[model samples]
Structure formats: structure tokens, C-alpha cells
Target chain A: MIPDDALVTATWDDLIERDGQALALSGNDVSLLSELATAAVLFCAEGDATVSAIAAHLEELFGAPEGADTSAAVREVLTTLQNRGVVSITG
Target chain B: MPWESGTAFRVLIVDAGNQGRSAVGERLLRRHLALNGIPADVIRVTSAGLNADDGLRMDVGAAAQVERLGGNAHGFRTRSVSAAMVEAATMLICGTWWEREELCIRYPRARGRAFTLSEIAHLYEELAVAAPIFDHPRLLDSRLRSSEVPDDFDLPPWEEFEERIVAVCDAIDEATRWIAEIWASMVPHHPQPKADGEEAAEPTCTLDAFGVAVAITCGGSAHEALSIAGKRAWGRCVVEDREAEADLTIVVDPDPDVLADARLTGALAYQDVDTALHHLSSAVTVRAIEARVGQLIMMHAAGLAGPDGSVVGFVAPSGTGKTTLSRTLGAHYGYVTDETLAVAPDLTVLPYAKPLSVIDALTHVKEQWGADSLDLAPLPDAPLRLTRLVILDRRENGPSTPVLTRLGHLEGIAMLAEQLSYLSKIPGQLHALSDLVDAVGGLSLLTYRDVKTVLPLMPVLLAGSRR
Candidate 1:
């Protein structure tokens, strides 16, 4: 199962409430989060998955098609959210 | 050579020297191109003087004249025409016939390419008369390629300089139709064009071209939408940065699950990027950004600057007729920003020439329009300084003329505080505002019904501020 501390339940709720509302984001951040959202959805589906497992899944789905570094992108997003205290990182 | 590549078309305006007629022509030509929906990156415009003292700034009078005609007169510096400039020019427009002859003599290769402004205008007119249906750029190309050099008209008197500039601009405007057509033809078509009514799949966002840098954190699709919105609203201020050290950080968390939880704290969160954008738009995002920037910097009242670099800020709440007065005063004065006037601690005004937002009658929604689109004059190339603050107390059927009364700094700050963006956020905001009041020296109470009634009092108001 996903770590209890790992899920950003409260922040996610607030974000959903504010959706379709007037909020602004930089173009880059928007793209980054969108990428993360796709990966996060997949990660959550597995019920119990490590960050490495999620990164590997993302690589398989997006890496070759987009010629992107999925691992770095995933790490960055997770770290950013963790730093902001929006999500707790539990190994 | 650049034009030959089919990627970009370069037009060089040649004059006797830089900073005078040709400089003005360059600005006018660029304005006409922009008005016609021609992007600057595609068709590059530059000016050069035959005998220019390179690096000299454009003449203030000429710059002001360009501004009056709704063309930007900022960032202009004189430069002598060079062989490279002549060689690169797909079309060489001379300010006068004399300049054309000089170009032909100095650079023989430019002979077939060079044409006086009037000559180009005449050619455009002749082409239009002949075919009538042909586009502007094709006709322009036909004229430029032709061996014939049309004769020039007699130069107008010095006193009729403004009139002459207007006439030249009119001619250029006539020619730009084809210029735009040619530019459109050259644009590379996207491999996969978006279907009608289809929302962009990916999020693309840029900083407002005319506004401050905003760090946007949102999903992909939202980013793309913001990019489109930013272009439409902010012009060229959009930037790309994953890590933005911005004045304001806008966090967009559009996940329904994330937003449903009540435990969210810290950054402002949105349900999705679209909702966040919607909120920002309705909230007047540009104003919000400006207000936020003011917290970091110094914020002043909205207004225009005179030729002497002195700004006249109109302080009033929304729906109090500030826009109407700004529009009216803009015609006669150097048009500064209509919404927020951002100043350095030194009191120098920064140019935030965002499109003026006017309320649409049918939808009752505020629509943004470029300064050129509204026929508003551009701000002159001068260091803008805050000189006067006018507190607008617009009353219907109250007075036939505007009554001007001076207010103490305390009253001015109190009045100004209401209109200030993010006043509470700025550290030492009161002291900064007080310093600004001292620098400009008090405020004027402009009580009036109609803008026309206040027109005659502008000079008096400006003069009174100097005392």
C-alpha cells in the first residue's frame, strides 16, 4: 500500500477545489506537474510502489517516445512537493 | 541574404543620418507591420543614416512625433548605414530621394533595391490601380524588383514635419497589406494543426510580455492554456522556466483528489490549471502581478508622462472614470501605463505598456487591446519620473469644469492606499509611499464629470505641481 505519509491528501483536496478557478502557473511548472500527474496516477494504481518502480514505469511509457529523462523529472517533482511540505517523502 | 533564405525578410530604412527622419520612419514602418498582424521576428525592421553619427540617440522631437502616431520611440540609437546593412536589406526605403542617390552611389548594388518612401507609396498605388486584387507584399516585391527608380516629391516645410510623417506612415500602411500577405505565405505550417473547438492537449505558459515574471506551477494542459492566454493578454512577457525566482509564485494544483482534502496549507492551490487561470483573469492578473511587484518595488498611481519625463498618475478606485480620463489624456500626453505605474525607489517610472483593457458593451467583459490598435500614441523615449498625482473624484452632472485642489501627504497616502496593489505586503510601504509623495510633492483633487472639461486645466495642474 502507498505510505500513509506519502499521499498529499489535504493539499490534493484544496487543489481540486481551486481547479477551474483563477490561479496562475508558469509555463514550465505547468508542464512539469502535468508530467508528474500522469506518472502519479500510474504509481497510485499499483497500490504499493516505490519511487524507483514509478520512475521505471514512467520511463517505459514516456522516455522513448518523448526522448526525455523521466527519472530526473520524477525526482524533481517529488523533491519539489516534499520541500514545499505539500507531500511527505517516506522511503 | 536573410530574406533570400525564405526564413526572414529584412527591411532597412535609410536616411541622411540616424536619429531623425529615418529613425521615425523605422518606428512607423514597424508599427504598420505590427498593426497588420505581421510579427517582428519574421520581418525585421532597422534604420541607418547615410552620414549618421553612430550611437547618437534619436531626436526628441522626432521620437515624440513617432509616439504621437502610435509608434514606439524607445530604444532608438543612431547608426550610420553600413555596406553590410545595405547588402542584407531585401528592400531599402530611403527617407528622401537624396538619401536614395547617396545609397546608389555608395553601394551600387543597392541601386535596383533603393526607393524613396514616396516612391514605394506611388508604386503601391500604381500596383493597386493596375491589378487592384493583388496583395500588398507581392506588389511591394514587384516594385522592389523593377529597375525603375520613381522620382521623389518636394520635401515639405520643416514646420509640417508631423504632417509629413503622417503622410509617409499612410503610404507605408498601404504597402503593408502585401508585406503581411508575403509574411503569411512564408510561415511554415504546423504538421498537425489543432482542430476547431479543440482545447490544446498540452499546457504552454509564458510570462506576460509586458508584465512581470510569474512563477506558474500547474499541469501540462493548463500550461499550454496559460501560454495562449498570456499571448492574448500580455503580448511578449511570457517566459519559460521550470524554476522561476519570480515576484509571485502561483501554485496550481488542479487534481480533484488533492483539492478535496481540507488539510492543504502553504501556497495557494487551485483545483486545476484552468480554474486557476480563470481566477487570475477575472481578478485582472496583470494588475495583480503589478501590485505584487509593487510590494517588492515601489508602486505609484496610474497615469501618463509628459515630454519632460514627468508622470501624472490618476489615483481612483475602479469604475471611477480613470480609464476614460487616461484615454483622453493619452492623446495629448506621452501615454504611460493605464493600470499600474511601477516606479523605482528613485521614482523613475518603468514602461508597462500592456494593452489597455476596455469593457466590451455586448458581453460587459473587459477586453485587452494593444496600444497601437486603440490609436493611442506611444510613450516618448524619455526617463519617466513621477511628477504629479491627480485624485479623480468624478461626479455626474456635478461640475461643468474640473476643480483642482491640493491635498496634504497624509491625505494623499490614504487616498493612494486604496488603489495601491499589495500595500500590506510591502515592507516599509508607508515610508516608501511617503517618500514618493515628497518627491512629487502632494496630490491634486481632480473633481470633474467629463474628461473634456478637464482638458484646459491639465497645463494648470502640471504647472501647479511644480510650485
Candidate 2:
């Protein structure tokens, strides 16, 4: 699991949200992701915050759907963002 | 009928030197006129400053010029002409940029009449390259003159500034090309008169890019311009032996530092070259009627495409962290406008992705992404397709998880109302603003304290949201 303190810096061109849908710009490319992933991506800037803390915060604020594997989902999303260099996992 | 039609008018830009640059600019002007196919009576005034004359007469002179142009002839006074003739021609009127602080204080009317600080900056650029002030070709480098530097700034090391200046010359040429394109789009050839009876007189356009009428007499000094703040400019008259009347005029105290910053690489000044071309478009002689237009929706902000073809948009009010958020997206998502997203007559949103303004406060992005990765260029270069409007807000709380809220069209309209320029304008502008709102979805994004908070949600947002 990536520590919340990990500094994840990326260059984006634009950010768009329509109806419940959203898109993000990173360099010249665009990515379509779920709202949960959207929240997770933004959370990458939290220093020393754990994935669970990030997820819990999101759940409380956005009222994420209950009964889903929130931690697992957060982990999965963070790992993907890690691979893309949009975020980093740190102690 | 995008804007109210204007009267017939003309402008002449003469450089002190480098006939080549002047020639290039003149050619573009002519091409623009031809493309518009508007018939206008134009004459060139080749002299420099408040004096000197190169007699190129036009059909309209004196009173006719005053009626059509301005009532005064200060704009037309030439050093070559007699003072009596100059006065008779009303040639000593103040042009827009000629002002002093004291004059403005003594004359409150001058406060808002002069050109904007930004506009004046742009005008200096046009004049600097328009003609050589002197007979010599001096390289004007932006890097050497910043507000921090001295007035008579020494030129920077040759190799450093040389490449950038050359690039600027090329960029200027490109801007002229873009101007030609806009002219072609706006001007239609006057229809030939019917074979049977008398032909109709086609009206001409007379406004500049800023939406101000070209015939409005811009004040002579900054103070005077400000004195008439918010008032329509007075018109100018042409004198037979003097310079052509200038609707607007600008003068500046040469500041090497300011000049240097303006010439910086990847600066907006580079793009100003292109914007000036738009003003020239308004003068196209093919159609004599001027169009009063202020808005130029440079690009669409939504419907951005992902690597896999998914699309989204980044929305935020001006000065919001929209650009910061955008540049942070990096290679992950496609970008649109940092300012506006031009929506087509159809529902589709076009992107106007331009350079993102990274402020001094946001240091983390630079730390994470190497500085080179963050180097942004001006707007003319960045273009993207938009999918949605993600309005970003700065919340004291750290980056929040993305919230997917749905808004009705009416609600969307309400949210978008704040985005248009000049809400106080006529009913027509208001209608256009409302129409734009109906076309796009709306969202309220509260930014968290940490960048990490938003990183986890990228893939899902890229994938699209569910109701």
C-alpha cells in the first residue's frame, strides 16, 4: 500500500465533469475513470495518509455506495495510478 | 447577425524601418480585405510620429472624413504640413495612448478612456516590429528587458536571445496566416448587382477585435483617454496633406524590462501577433460593414478524449485551480481550453486547451513532475476535444473524493451563468450565454488539501460516471 505522504505530481491539460461523468487531462492524453477513482486520484496528494484513510474520507464525503469492498477498490485504483506515474506509493 | 453592424472605416499602420515587416503586414491586410470581399476606400500614411507625410490620397477628405471618421484631424497632422493646415484639419487631437498621471488626476474623464494596460503592451509589440523606429535593425529581445531591469538595457548574450527572436519572427508570420483564415470565414463577397436594376450599396464593418468601433476617437493621452472613460470614442477627420486619422492611438515610455518580459519565450506576446491579425480582419475592404464582436470562443473545454477514446472535461471558474488541475493531469487525459470551451451550434463541445497558468503557491506539482514537464506554452498551440465541465473549487479540506452529482439542464444553465464575459451587455449577449449553459452539464468539485486525494479516482472518472 502506498503511504499518503507520497508526492505524486503529474501534468494535466484539462478536467471535465458532465452529469455524473468526468474526464482528466495528463500531458496530451485523456483518461475516463469512475467517480471513486476520481476521488482516489485526487487523494494521491495527501501526505502520510493511508489508503484506508483516503477511502474512508471519500466514503464519508461523497457517500460512496455501501456494501462494496472499499479498501480493495482503493488499493486497485491506487496501484493503477502508480503504474501510470500519476501517483506513487511510499512509506 | 452575431453583432450590430458598423460603419465604413480604414486604418494605416506604418513602421519606421524594415520595409520587409511592413510589407508582410500590409500584404496580410490586403489579403484579408480580398477574402472579405468588402469594398472600402483606403489610403496609406507612411510618415512616422506626429509629423511627416507620404501623400497617398483617398476619395474621402476633410469634412467627409470627419463625418465618417472623427471630427478632429490631429490623427492626420503631418510634420510636413503647416500648423495652420494641421489645426484646420483638426490634426492635433490626442490619440488614445498619450496620457500622464497628473492629467488623469486633474481630468477624471481620462481614467477609463485610454487603452487597457494589456492592450498597450500589445500595441508596443506591433509598433516595435511594425517599423524600425530608426533606420537600424535592432534586435528586440524580451529576455533583456524586464520591469526589474534598467531602461537602456544591454542586449543579452547573442546566442541565447538570437534563436528566440528568430522563432518569434516565424510565429508572427503564422499569426498572419491565422488572421487570413478568420477574415475568410467572416467576410463574404458583395453579391453582384442584379442584371436588371440598380445595385444595392453593401454596408461595411467598422469595429476592432475588442468590440470597440474603429471610428470611436480613442483619446490622445492616457489621462485624456481615462477622462472619457466608458464613453464612446470621438471620431477623427482626415486632412488632405496630413497623416491618416487614427481612431485609437498609443504611446509608451520605453521600458527595457517590460519590453524584455514581453519578448520572453513561450510568452503570450508571441500569441498577440496572431490576435492583432484579427483586428486587421475587421478592416477588410471587400465588405465595408464592420461587425461589433468581442467574444472569440477559442476552443471547447469538454468532450476530452482519453487514450482509449473515452472523454471528459475540466471546468473551473477563472483564477480557480483549473489550469493547475489540468497540468497535473499530464499525459493521462487530453486537454481543452484553460479559459473557455467553444460549443458548436450543435450540442458538441469543442476544446480550447491552451497554456495552463501555474501559480507560485502550487509548488508540489513542480517537485513531483520535473520542471521541464510543467513548461506550458501560450493558448494558440494547445487544442483538445471536450467532453464535460469539471468545475474545480478550492476547499480548505484536503483533496476530496470525486463526487458524481447530476444536474438538470435548467440547473446547468444556472451554474454556467457566471462563466460568460460581460453579463451586463445587451439582451443578445445574455441570450447567447444562456444558450451555452443549456448545452453543457455542470458540476461542483471541492478540491482537497492534498494532491494524493484526487489521484486514486482518475481511472474511474476516465471511464465515465453512473447516475
Candidate 3:
């Protein structure tokens, strides 16, 4: 779970900016835990909405799907994200 | 010495006095060898005459050698040995240089004959550079005249002599190309020994860019495949051939001086292998990933591109009508890439609507678009460019609607950064990424349920094109 707030997006070669000016990020910008967690999040929360929305809409989306364990997948992603500090709650 | 007489090789060491840097270079070479599963005894050639801590180390064995004498192969000089000799030796060991006049000529009887030809041309070129006398023999001093040649033939017209000089240069170039081909062939060449007996142990390269798992396999042709994958992933790869079971092997020689070293041996093909890896990992693949992530971050969480630079991009996330809509649009635009879109810095989403990789052939994208209609060509050579970006969202039993939202600078840049794979500790990455987002016009395009619903909005995105 890349920090929704901390995550800064840009084009392939675009310079990062803060307050209309270019900003610099060093080696400290990356968190190993977050990168791994983000993978989990993408795999889990990819179908229809954001990570938070997936957590809320889990039953509605995957409850009826044959052989679906939406809750477990969401929990796995949440645990990974929570451990990495990208998410606030585990449930 | 006679045992290895036919074996020609060269040792090049530049600025070897720089102990720390040289040591680093040596370690890099060793690591490269191990990564590529090259079997050769590592022999460091540090003579007693030179300082032990600060002398050069040369790897020698049954396998070939490509070592950098100095930083630059073309211009390094040694007190005991000539640069030309070292370069020749390297070429021989690497087994890349060969005859040019006879294209199919394999290893000739002479060890350093190919490089000698190069040197001969170089000498002539050097003379021509110093004085245009070769081109204009009339300018030659009488003292420099060769007695072996008749005076009438010795001093020809400037144009005629210039033509002769050009021909020599062409010959040299032709030889270089021939040698390059021989060397390049070694990269993928292997002796097919009936595919019997013990299969050679698979050489594996495990490169962890931070945590990005890059597993490179080296075998008969797996090394090539691994290289291709690494190139796609924007990771470094190298191949070192043992010249035995593995005629061509990819090794991760991360030594900064490997290029310089390979030059010493005249291993043009080996050098080219590294050069190709460098180009793929650093330049092309990195740019592709950046573009993919950029489209994600800056635009309305949508992938867009016009195949053949014509139609609009059908932007949508996974499970959205994006793929279904893309298939329809691909018919018109020619499908640049299916999964990703290359949004250039100038605010154009280059379509990558290549062959739709349909897991379930029965899906709407595969069914309506039909397998034949999709462009299945690989992305590298595929045709497409961005004319418009149409974001998609599925609405069951509802008409497809197109809505555009302005994606500003920071927001857009943030979105694109999500897909950056090569975020190594490079200084320029942050700034370069930001600049890219600003250059591309970012927007969020909303899509309705039906794939065809997004068709009308294609012309609208094209209108923003400054192209």
C-alpha cells in the first residue's frame, strides 16, 4: 500500500514538485515494506475501486463469485499494508 | 607457451595505478563471470616490478579473456607493450574478429591478423590525418618518396589518390563489420552436440534491484531469453562464453571498466553484447516503464494511445470496458499496446494496442473485436501513437458516457510515479519524472457501460494535440 498521501505520481521523466516547485527525493523515498504491500494491494484491489473502497465493498463484489474469498484477499492486502504503515486499520 | 601459441589474446589496463577503482573493476569482472556461469581460472597479473596493491589483474585460462587495459581501448599506451598489440590479443581471446573479404571465413590460421589489418588502416589514416600527402602526393616531400615504387605511379592526382585512401578506409570498415558479425554470432552461437549426455548446468543470474526480482537464466538459448526479459524489466545483463558446452552465455559483468577491457582483447562482439544490454536496460525499457506509469499517474487513471498515431485512446482500468472499447478502437487506430499506453512528454498517449492477450477467449473484448482484428505484434516494433485519451468505467445496462476532468500538475505527476520501476538511487530521477508529467496534458475520461459508447470522444482528445 503506497501511502495515499506520501505517494507522488509523475510522468516517466517528469520532475517531482511541491507547491509548484520541483522537489527532490533521495533513497529515503522508498520503503521496502510498502513496495511489497503495494503489489499485494494491486493484486487484491484491482477489480473496480480504490483500496479503501475494496475493503468496504468486499462482500458485495466477491461474496457471490464462485470459489471467491474476497475477505481473505482483502485482509491479506490490509495486513501487508498495515504492517508497512500504509494503512491505519488491519480489519 | 607453444601449447597456446595459436590462441591470441591481449591484456589492457588503463590507470591501473588507481588502486581503489582498479580493485572495483576487477571485482566487477569476477562477479560478471560468476553471474554468467563462465568457467575460467581467475589469474590476476600483478608483477613484482609494479606495486602489489596497485597493479593490474588479468584473468587467463582455457576460456577467452576480455579485459580493459585503461579506461579507453583506442587510446591507451603501455611502457612494455603497444596498445595495438594488447587490442589484438583481446580480439583473439574473445574470438570475435575475423576475415572481411571472405564473409564466411571462420578462425583463420593467423592469431592477430584481423587486428593487424585494422592497425594498418589506422596507420594510413593517421598518416592522412598528419599530412594530406597521401591524397595529394604532390605535397609529399621528395625525401619521403619510396624508392620501391616508380615515380610516375608514386605521385598520382589528388582525387585518384584520395579515392585509393577511401577504398582502404572502406576495406578497414568492412573488416570491422566482419569481425563484429563474428563476435555477435558468438553471443547466440553454441555447438549442437546431439543434445545428449549431461545437459550443462543452467547458469542463473539473480539481480535484485532493491527488491525487484530479476532472475536471469543462462543455458543453450535461455541466456538470450533472460537478456530479453531483463531488457524489458530495465535491468543490467551480461554474457560470458566458456567456448565449450556454452558457446554463448549471458553474464552480469557490472564492471564500469569492462568496456575498456573488452576493447583490449578486440572482442567487438562481446563489447556489443554489453552495449546492447546497456541500451535495453537503461534507455529503451526504462523509458517504456516510465511512460506506462506516467499514463497511469498523470491521466485519469486511464491508459490511452492511438495505434498508428491516428485514433483515440480507450482509457480504463482493469475490468472496466477499457479493453472491450480498446478492441473496437483498435480496429480504427491499429492497436499500439494492449495492456499499456506510451504517453509521450508532449501530452500524446501513444497507443500500444497490440495483440489482445485474452485469457478467456469468450470475453467481450475477444468476442466482438475478434482474434484476427487485434494487432498481436510485439510492442517494440508495433505501430501506434496518441490522438486522444478516453477514460472508461463500466455501467451495466447504461449508455456509455464520456466525461473529462482536468488533471493538474502535482496530481498528474503523482499518478504516473506509481509505475516507476527503475527508481534506483539516481539523482536525476525525481526531477526528470516531474518534468515529464508537466509536459503531457493530463485528463480523466469517464466511460459508460458499452465499449462503443466511447467512440464519439476520440476526436475531442485529438483536438488538444499540438502535433
Best-matching candidate per DockQ? 3
Instruction: Give i-RMS (Å) per prediction.
Output: 18.8, 16.3, 15.2
Candidate 3 versus truth, CA RMSD in Å, comes to 27.4
Which runs in model 3 stand beyond 4 Å of their true positions? A1-15, A18-91, B1-321, B343-353, B359-399, B423-430
Model 1 ranges off by over 4 Å: A1-91, B1-205, B208-211, B215-230, B236-244, B247-300, B424-429, B460-467
* Residue-wise C-alpha lDDT for candidate 2, range B412-440, written one tens digit per residue: 43344333322223133334444444444
lDDT of 3 at B353: 24
Off by over 4 Å in 2: A1-91, B1-304, B308-310, B360-385, B407-409, B422-447, B463-467
State the TM-score for model 3: 0.31
Writing each residue's lDDT as its tens digit, candidate 1 over B269-367 gives 344544344334322333234334434333324577677777777875544566677778878877676655666677666666555656678986556
Top-lDDT structure, candidate number: 1
lDDT of 1: 0.55
Displacement of residue A21 (Cα, Å) in model 3 is 9.4
lDDT-superior candidate, 1 or 2: 1
